[model samples]
Target chain A: MFSVMPDSAVRIRDLRKTFGSVEAVAGVDLDIGDGEFFSMLGPSGSGKTTVLRMIAGFERPTSGTIELGGRDVTSLAPFDRDVNTVFQDYALFPHLDVLRNVEYGLKVRGVPRAERRERARAALRSVRLDGLDGRRPAELSGGQRQRVALARALVNEPKVLLLDEPLGALDLKLREEMQVELKSIQRRAGITFVFVTHDQEEALTLSDRVAVLDRGRIEQVGTPAEVYERPATAFVAGFVGTSNRIGAVRVRPEKIHVGIEPDAGSGGESGGPAEDGPGRDGRAEGGAGTGDRHAFGTVAEVVYAGPATRFVIDLESGDRVVALQQNLRTSSMDVTRHRGARVRIGWHAEHEFSVPETGAGTAPAS
Target chain B: MTAVAGRPAPGLRRRAAALLHRRPLLRLSLLLSAPLAWLVVAYLGALGAIFLTAFWTTDTFTGEIVREFTAVNFQTLWDEPVYRTIALRSLGVAVAVTAIDMAIGLPMAFYMAKVARPRHRPMLVSAILAPLWAAYLVKAYAWRVMLAEGGPVDQALEPFGLSGPGYGLTATVLVLSYLWLPYMILPVYAGLERLPGALLDASGDLGARPLRTFRTVVLPLVYPSLVAGSIFTFSLSLGDYITVKIVGGRSQLIGNVVYDNVGAANNLPFAAAVATVPVVVMLGYLAAARRTGALREL
Candidate 1:
């Protein structure tokens, strides 16, 4: 079911890497489009970084092939590959100044001194580190060093740029800032960027397409929205974003609505305030006319986050589900009052996705 | 509270500890006093006496130090062509030994630090250090036997229609390099061990081949440790007299001259004057090495 793109920048066929007895990158197939900002998103030890390293020729596949720009580079040394990696540690040469670190690739390739200097300076400018050429990597701040690493890799103008959690070392504010800068840089460079990160939010925010890896295998590969909305596997559903599994179906927290169940004699238009007691019945399911699946549950916990409030409900169907509500109209007091109150949780049928149960047992907790 | 029945009233040790805690500078001085005194008196005092004696002359008739400060000893050292030759030869041997040690030590250290499996590293380091546990004279004498006529070195070379350079500057340098090789390997190994593997990967990812990466990345970063290792090899080779005596047949080095004047001729002042040469050269070498910021690594 995998379509092979004729102009794909990177293509892998059953790529596998085994470290002794442990399989790191199990058999996998992928095709990354030219100039696409692709991300291999996974938790630590999920083999995303190994895949990226194999793509960069830092690693060799155990029994498969990796094609870069349609050339089989499985046996080539890292230097022979037309890709550069911005290491997780930045890996800027501690002995060289920023400009020289950027100019190293060109220098080794026998680029003339004057031309390489000019190109390196331009690269430094692209990363917005123009005046800090004389400063060594140790002299720069964390974010600045990260930029120098980016500039060093970018200066080569390789066919692909591999970034292995380049922003993982930065603080939250700086990482967010770098995310914007990196996206813009990738756009301007128009080089196929294969970014690897364990941060799901970063993968979703930065990548045009993301491959979610689990246990050395790709669980799902799709656009961020597709992975988030219609996760192919239960693992992807739980990993990419918060998923509330209700039996065989999964629904996002934000899509589930929690409301006070109306009394038996009350009209359907409005539900009166939920009584200060346990849910009316242990099990109830209705609202089929509106094509909405409904369940009766007691609000187990009410969490008031600043922008949104989360309600953890233990449904009567022997399953627990969390529902998120924006605080645009509900204040802290309004959401906090839902604790122990009888409520009806409902979601549109379209929002419910039936994920395969193969990897469900090993999916990370929501 | 009746002084807490059985508790001793501020024992001398407790009181001293409290006093020490209250006065940091006093405590620091007390902590450093013994070693500081030994360094100043025994080490610096001896060095100062040597420098002082280098300026003094001997009473030629009575065979005693005149205690009269004069440049005559230094003048004699300068005027004598043999002394100059020995000093230059000694300097040359130290430089050659250091060079040879580096050439061998670097790759050995790299293999031990980076290429070897992690579990095997400690064993490799101890292997490099195993020779150091033997007595210096024992090792030198062993080399002396090895370099003797029809010795292993000579017999090995005989099949190739060549003979070993028996007992001379070549033998001195060969033996000295072997003796000081551990010194070079240790620092270089520590430096290479401290070098992060990602830096090498990053260099290769930047399109530089392995050799280029070593030249551009590994060598420059490891240079400080190389200098640190050279400090040990250079100074040890420079001040060594026993090794040269064991292998050097007719050649004389600065250390040999210093020894000969003191032992055979009973010329303490002239011996001290000759001793100052290596000390001066070491000081110069240290200044240059410090400029490279290698002393910090040591």
Candidate 2:
């Protein structure tokens, strides 16, 4: 659930965008609080970028109202709006140097030469690019170009900043580094950031609240922990992380414990309600205790990942589940021996949540 | 390698490919030899001959090319105010034609490359090139008819209480502009096409209105192509004589003087000397353009 702010930074009501007969963004409503880093996370064609563009005034919605800082900007052009976008390609002016590129917005607004230059320099310094202002964008590395793009938008001091996968082009290490820098920049500037990315890890790492989208609709909007732990819909449960369907509930892979022996005490055919489970604090810990549910299965496969080992189990109840265990005490040979071994999977019932199955032709109970 | 040689050696084609692969410069020269020879003999050789002729003199009484090295033709060109006027007028016409073509070509190119739908772009390019398929002389004569005393141009301006330019220098510039518009549009369209659409979007997102974005972002990036287009329009207009003869009325340009001297006056040396003026002017233009890094783009 999203908290109600008195004056939200951006509020959209019944937004829809259609290209010909295909609807890119179906009717939706959202409220982004001021200074909050909110992300729209989805797959490539899931309309997350469309929603961000609509918020930035780059794309007009077919029938909806968009309010920015309590002002209606539905029909306004991008230049008239008080929000800037960090384009996916960085889009720095190739002909202009970094300083001039950053000063462009101020110059176009009639800011005097001396003042704009000083501000542009300060903006560049904020991004840790002080002496590189005279260098062309082509001369800088990809990460530097990304910083310049950020400074160019931040120098305008808009109410909100929209980034359309700005770090999508960077390598893995640089992307992680820039993610930290971006979070710091947002904090220093105190501007509401509407980040759109198909990278689920990036969205979870940087955003205060994440909106998981599927097709043209938001599957769930919540904190990263809430979305990952208690997904509202089956699509969210599947997209955010790996989940296994057990009867009427979906459980995460890490919640299920793979053991060689079934415990005598609370390992009956039917289990009781759990008092403390992974759902309480979003962590999978502790040994099986009373009220822990049990399932009989055999290890179908064992995957020895660097940090953890995954066990695929085929249950006697005709359900399949994957259980992950940290390799703190087990070596590669120890975990690899579990392949085809008879095992028992157990987890607390509170770790499971009911998700409405999408496109199953049955009405959702919730 | 010895075993392969004993097994009847590799085929000639394979052996040649192996040799060429071993020596890249040899392969490159082999590839370029034909075109290089043609370019040297047919193009640069003709230019060298013309430059050499420019220093020779024509025998005035016999009307023969004496082939004697002399500055008399150059001296005559300098002393006669008429030759200077013709050269200046030619330069003026070239500048006007280039300017007009650019003013019209840039917007047309932008619309084709950016505004038009992707499916419609090829059709728009074909339409822009449609005029180039027509004969150059036909188009020039067509403009001549339109600029006639009471023709279509004059009739169209009748309601505005204005008359046509009436087949003079303005008419020549107009005809040449029409003839060479495709050259301007093609290169500019290519440059604008290579420009990413996100750059324009980024400019507008940075609080620049469309006009400001065009001035600061679009114009600067597309400047090289504009220069490339002007090279075609400028040089083509400078060396054109037939269009002027068809629609120039009484105006005389450098091309017309060169043509008259070589034809009626039978003064080959004088014509070659006059021809060098445009060549020299073009050389200066190209050097200036190269300094701006426009030729690198071409």
Candidate 3:
């Protein structure tokens, strides 16, 4: 479908970076398709920003060949590479007005003045920052500066635009609004955007494909739903959202069904909190749930968030597991009203996925 | 509580604090009075007396202060080619020193702040500032010894078949740039240190090469500090007559004119007029530097 254009906008092969004895990005291989809105989601030290910087040619990888549109640009300087970055702080020049800042890249590349101005203005207009060409970055609000940073990069029409937590500095409401606006801008521009963010929800909301990095290695790469619904590793399950560890098995807290309370010793299968009747929830199933699984726990605490009530459960013989129940009705009989109540948490066999107790066994997908 | 035996007197301290709290103006005056007194009395007062004397003249032969209000000194200043030459030569030395110091200090400061490892940065700064510890005259004499016809400078340049420019405007500029380099380096270092690393990366990511980034991003941001540092170099170089005396073999800067007229020639009025040149030059420089946001940095 991408005629003449390389299938992958950016191809990272065995990319690795190390600082002294510490490896920041460990042998990551990813092929981000052209026009794809991809996100690298990880914690602060997970090497997500480092990877983005390497792709932008800001950080040199210790060993890797990065290909942009089928041409290797691993050794090229940032200016030689056809990509730009929207820095977290926006990094707009304080001395220059918005127009000069936005036109800086084109000006450096020797684009004609009229053409540079016209393109910079159009880019600013696209970001909804029209009529702000004369204000210095210090004069603009945080949101306006952010849009100017975006406009500055977008004006370059680079092969890939790298963003390192571009919305991280905004307030919650502004962040959400900018998230939608950024995604829409990505769609309109049709240029590949490789965004780095620690916010999983933001990643899920904005990315077409998401890659989870942990301890400088990619744990999983898939569609947002795939990574969120079916986490490939224990870290993914824990980091992406909330997950309940029912013994060795990991299941989504939202997928588990909670019963009012369980009897101390009911040994049957007919929904009597039993152990044998379709209660193949036997401990022999390890973590990957077999058929259906049932566990008994006491609801030690109930947290009432607006839409959902999270019940922190103390399983009979394992670590605490949490179950989420949506408050469909506005009645006051919340699960909180039944704190210290014994509850039965069960999930379908398919809802349960096995993960390594530790992160030693996974292999990169290449 | 019982009456304290070992405690220091609190009544006086408490009463003073209470008085200050009741009248903040008293606290403000207490904080400002000493510096203000020194500045007005020791600095501006002397400047006012000197400028006033520039309007008076002395007897030509009697060697007595006539103290007559006259424009003779200023007229002589306006009509003399010697004064013009000295003024222009001094101005040239100041400008050259500032330019050379900036040329050397910028890259050195950039290296110290950005390129050097953090562990080594303090050592670099100390080395840059270490020369200031030696007395100025001692260092200038040392340079005098080094710049002699067959001295260390000649020895160093002998292998290259080149010789140092000894004891002239060039020598004065070289010594002044050497002395004022740390002044320029420290401020520019501080300015570069305050620059966000992300800005450099952002500029490069925006398709600016290293030189381009330095020009557009680094230069503009650090320009104020450059101006601030130049103030020290320019003003100090302009007013210096000692280095010119030791290493300036035959050179006559404005400072030399002031010293000769005031002391050797016994023409205080003419000396005051000559000294006024540097003061006016500096005021003009400061006014110009203000537009570049240099005052805020200073």
Candidate 4:
């Protein structure tokens, strides 16, 4: 893994933004490393886009300092800033041909006609949209239009590229494909990308670091694994992944152990921890729980996905937990039989993380 | 075919309904065609009578068309540079008014379309066209007083130690431009109102400054509207008689010239001949507008 760059590409410190009665972006502080793939992960109305717009110089922060490549550019206009944006609508000029749209920035900067044309062609080629220079935006498909928007931004060679749900318009398959293409392009271009998306999997899959946003505030910031396994708050854990939280405690991914039933009382008391189990503490002790044995629950539902069977278990505390397993083998009895059947679900103590609760009766401010 | 919400109407009933609806349309078309045909016929007949009269030598005593054929009137018009000079002056005034209308209308239209709020935009746009809604004669009379020596404009200037020029071609041009500015503003505003805002934002993100973005992205998008508005302004100013008649005491354009020739001078043939210049110019502009795709946009 790459360590944080000493000279960050973007440094946002205590950035605050408010729109009339609503505070869209509360004080936010983030450092985006050079050439790093950074994402702001949040639900709708979480101020992720507002923050991105501020970085792109579209929205002036109410107060704070913003630095790009170690130079402060807080008061600059968007054109004066080094950042570029790919809007959700891909606002290509409907009147201009694709080539002109791509060459627009350089032309504005007074680049020579021949040189701008050559650069525009090269940018179009980079997006694999060569020979489409003659088409208008209306004549292109959704994906092609997206590529044109990319080419238009990329042609400027901006130091910071901000994507505001760029793939939000595409269908599922196309969005997935574009995700890969976008990641690869970012790598090749080696520009620091400040991607904004509400999709958790998208953020986790593409980002070197993710900042989980909630109610116009940054809840937690860490790598995908760090955020998923050790979310500082319950909101971060639940929002970033499908988490089964039991009060303030959550069942970790690998801790979700699955097995076929032995005989009745064969594993001892169902509520008690199993013998020889590496418990949550990573050590075995004489107690109701054992090493790798955390809790037991009855199977509430079993969904037979093509590759994996997802089981929802109801624990004694009435908390729900999900257990996923690959379909490596078939049992004599149907997996459906496990549904409504009393069963034991156990995991190591180390697989459970205790985090502060959210909403009403949540943990008091520290 | 019959109209349906989001779907195409099919079958014989739909076709029958569609055909039946066209009956009134056809009737309306015929009704409109009659007036246009009558005007054309009357104008042509008048031109034919005038051509014959121009050829006829005016009675030395009465100065009336004698209904004879002669080249003497054409000779007279060519012999004096005053007629040619007057004709060119009318063309110049019309051209100046049209150019001014276009220059003022564009930014106003752009502001209405892109900057004004949706609720206020209609009110603001209607305000721009308010002059057109006012009584035309009253507006012309008002301008006559305003541009006079002791009007509010002169009064305001008097405080600054300046005075009005009283009456001239310049005053007439100013009044005509004011009256017809709405014709240009409304259409250009309509064109800009139809343009989407997303296109502007996209241009900005693509690194275009505000001015560059307006020039390349916005101006081209509203080109048809601009042309349509300019055509209306040009034709209206060229063919206008009211503003010039009221404001121009002696500095008259072709409109006044045509009027004075037809009624006072009793020179119908020469008046008809003078009117033909504006018609030919308008037709040329209209052909150019159509070729450039402005008509479809309008």
Candidate 5:
């Protein structure tokens, strides 16, 4: 009922904010589609939180216009804006019970008593907190309190919901569970969600689309797979997950193939051209070409993770790359040995992408 | 096997520390007993003795306290119109002072805690507490002079054809409010300071205007501390006799009656009986505050 326009739930035009001398959020433009689960992903101090706060009206941009559903709300107060935020701390009122905390927004909007109760109850139920509505926030556990905060924000039925690291405080298991729960709730509610997180895995698992923020600027904005598989900058490549950098190109550890070199002592034998010989059946599954880009290196370290084993290799070409191999039906890591054994590693040429090379104490340009 | 050949089995200090570490309740009881004993004996015991004396009789002829248990003093206090008036006057003054201090302190404290610059916050706190540094008697006397006829206050209001509220109930109320303003502000400021910025931001984002936020979120969150602060103002005003004596021209409160009974009349039992009124009022006020969950903050 509060929305004035039909599409583009949130539209930010060249938004900027500076805290004295520090440019917290430099000029950035964004368009969030209606009913989209959009995430702003970054490392700490990457201006993702600042952008979310600006959209929620907690921060006034230095210069720009913000519109929700086509109505400009840049100058409007937070209360006047059709947006609600689930805070990082899950800021539930300690004095009020869960029901009252959930009903707070409606009560402030002068909602009728019985209707407010029903809406709050339904919101609580949506968060799986139906029977716990009478509990004070202090009495509830961390995850329960987080659900109360979510319920409190959701009962208002704002046009857009901003979540500022809402799952940052939970433990690993609880965080993973809440991630699935939050996404399901978003789907069921069909409200545009702008979730901010410094954790890349959380963003990738939850967002329909994600904007990669780097040092107060937008590095790239696309679907999670788009940002992950084809990062636009060296910083993004380094931040999202572990990427093996070979000069200007980056390839994931999982994409590289690792196996023993057939002839370890042969001086003229190179792994690439010497392939497609007898007893080379294992090399056919990977590497786009029959004799694709390959390197011969000695195993530096072997790390046996439960589902996968990672082998770090030091190439004779003076570059290093890590290759992760899944543990097939067998239980032992005997296939990849630790240290001093010469091995062959190869990856599809298309898996490699260009990224700038940056040295210590410097950030690569986007 | 790793022990040195010449080393003693264990030093007394190490052994004692190990024992203490193993028995936490014993350690805690040992640590708590001293302060707990002092609190019960020195503070609560004195209060118990005073309340006990409130039921005793005072011999009028010899100016001696008779140990016989009697309700004569309370009977006199209830029957007499003067005592009733004095108690009511004292209660009214205390309530007024508390109200005035809250009116001035809440906004000032809020500004200091939530809005002031980091560098300026300490200076604002210092300014609020600076007046408390002056001696209580000295401040009261200063107010006496300021409210005197042709004094600074009267002179300032001379051109407006108005005069100061010359030393009376009004003067007492004003001076007490001024004296205790920091007491009220400090607690409320500390409460507001500890309030996470995220809560206020969440309130605003939930479609609450600033005033509505204050009325609903900020006010309720800060209420316990506000009540904690009112405890200081109300009790101080209720039991104050020195400030009244310094600035009060003709006004007489419960404290004044107690003081007169104890000093001029040399009636200790009667004074003890009179003092019980303020104690009872304070207890009732505390009970009311506790029901609002303010005692938890305290």
Candidate 6:
């Protein structure tokens, strides 16, 4: 499966890095398509930044090779590699004006003075730092410094751009704005961008694909929608969003029959997978029926959020099912009306995704 | 309280409290005034006395200071080739010593400030400062023994058949350099240490080579320290009398000339005038150093 043809803008093969006794990045393989906004998401010590650093050539991998544009850059130094990094701290030269900072790479590449200035100005303008070219980094605000950092890297026109939590220091509103700005820039440049961030929402919002990392290893990799809707593991489910779990093999939303209530449902031995029945007592169990979900629960909590109403239902089989109902003009999932009321939770049997337990200990598979 | 409403107290206790509060300003002024007066009396007054003495003439008959003002002492300094040679030689030596000290001190300071591991750094800095903690007179006397004809340095050089003037100049530069090295290193090291580490990394990422980075980024950032250290080294070497006497091998510095005029020649007025030159030079260097960031640490 790993020996496929090189349709990727960047191919990472068996990449490994170690600092002292601590293995920062263990063996990993990945392929990022051209013009794709891919993000590596992880916690602080999860090796996301290490992988980004290796790609940027700030850190050399102890083993393996990095191929960009189908060219090997394993032993290449940072400047020699046709990739630029936007550091988290920005690392803008305090002594130089914004224009000079952006022009640094071009000058080193021996670009003509006038051409370099023109390119730098264009990059600055793209990042909305056109008129602030003469200002020093210390003179700029946090958001402005971030733009300058982005401009500095973009001015180089590298094959791949690596951003290490470039907007981590910004306020929430500013971060969202920059997320759109960065995505637009990536689209305009049509270049591969490997961004590193720990913010799950940011990764989901900006990334075409995201690789979740844990303990110097890739936990899972998928498109944002695929990972969010069909999380392969409990970690992905909990990390991407919130979830609730009860117990036993029960039924999913679409399979379970939703009746008003007959003596608060059956109170004895719970429902099991019948010979030709839809499912069983636990939502994530049973191979009884294809495209069939079943579960009965009391609507314990209903939260009417802005766009969707979230319902937390306690199943009769000692399980909880979380359901999100999109709020249309006349939707029935109102929390003030449904709270404490008994309701069966089910959806299209096809929409039910069962992720097998893998001893991950991830918030009861939610 | 009802009977005495709106009336202020004038009892003994209240009067005492009011007097005590009022006298704090007066007490503080009195306390600070003594040191201010002492500085004016001891430092400014002494300088003024020296300036006055510089214009007095020494009587040839009895070696007594003649009360009358005269330019005869200045004439002697101008007319004598020995005095002119000694003055030039002092400048030459001070400049050479300062240059060599700076060259070694700046890099050493850089290593201490930026490169040394935290666990080992304090010991190294203390070692540099250890020399200053010792008695300066004792260290100068120690060099006297070391630089003598049959001393350790000469004995060590006997095998190479090199021992006379080489010994004197080499010993002087070495001893002077060693004594003043800390003065130069600490300020420069502090400046380098206070520099932002992100700047170095940014410069490196921007494709500046190590040498280019040091020249453009590191050097300019530590200008204050360099200026401060150079002034300190030059001024300290200029005013030193014992170190030059020990290692100079009878070669005269301005300090030596002033000493000779006061002690051997009994020409106090001439010595006072010669001493005034260094004070002027030191004041000028200090002013310039302060304008830069050099004097900030001190």
Q: RMSDs, each prediction? A: 4.0, 5.2, 5.2, 7.4, 4.9, 8.4
iRMSD of prediction 5: 0.8
Instruction: Give a tens-digit lDDT track for model 6, residues A34-140.
Output: 87889998789889998988886777899989988888988877656778888898988777898988998888778999999999999999998879888998999
Q: Give per-residue lDDT, candidate 1, residue B281.
A: 92
Highest lDDT among the candidates is held by which one? Answer: 1
The CA lDDT at A338 in model 5 is 41
Candidate 4 local lDDT, B111-226, one digit each (tens):
88888788899799779867778899999899888988799779988978998756778888788788888888888888888887767766676667898888998889888888
User: Which CAPRI tier for candidate 2?
Assistant: medium
Query: Can you rank all candidates by lDDT, best first?
Result: 1, 3, 2, 5, 4, 6
Query: What docking class should model 1 receive?
Result: high
Model 1 chain B lowest lDDT segment of ten: B1-10
- Worst 10-residue lDDT window, candidate 3 chain A: A282-291
Q: Specify the poorest-scoring 10-residue window by lDDT in model 1 chain A.
A: A282-291
What's the TM-score of every candidate structure?
0.92, 0.92, 0.91, 0.79, 0.89, 0.77
lDDT of 2 by residue, B52-163 (tens): 8988987789887798888888899999999999999999999999999999999999999999998999999999989988888889889988999999999999999999
lDDT of 5: 0.85
Q: What is candidate 2's CA lDDT for residue A270?
A: 39
Q: Which candidate is the best by DockQ?
A: 1
Q: Which 10-residue window of candidate 3 chain B scores lowest in summed lDDT?
A: B1-10
- Residue B157 in candidate 5, Cα distance off native in Å: 4.1
DockQ of 6: 0.34
| lDDT (tens digit, per residue) of candidate 5 on A109-193 | 9999999999999999999987987888889999999999999999999889999999999999999999999999999999999
- Which wins on DockQ, candidate 1 or candidate 2? 1
Worst 10 residues of 6 chain A by lDDT: A273-282
Instruction: Tell me the tens digit of each residue's lDDT in model 3 across A241-341.
Output: 99877777788888876664222212233434332222233332322112367777776888878887777888888678887766654245434666776
The better candidate by TM-score, 1 or 4, is 1
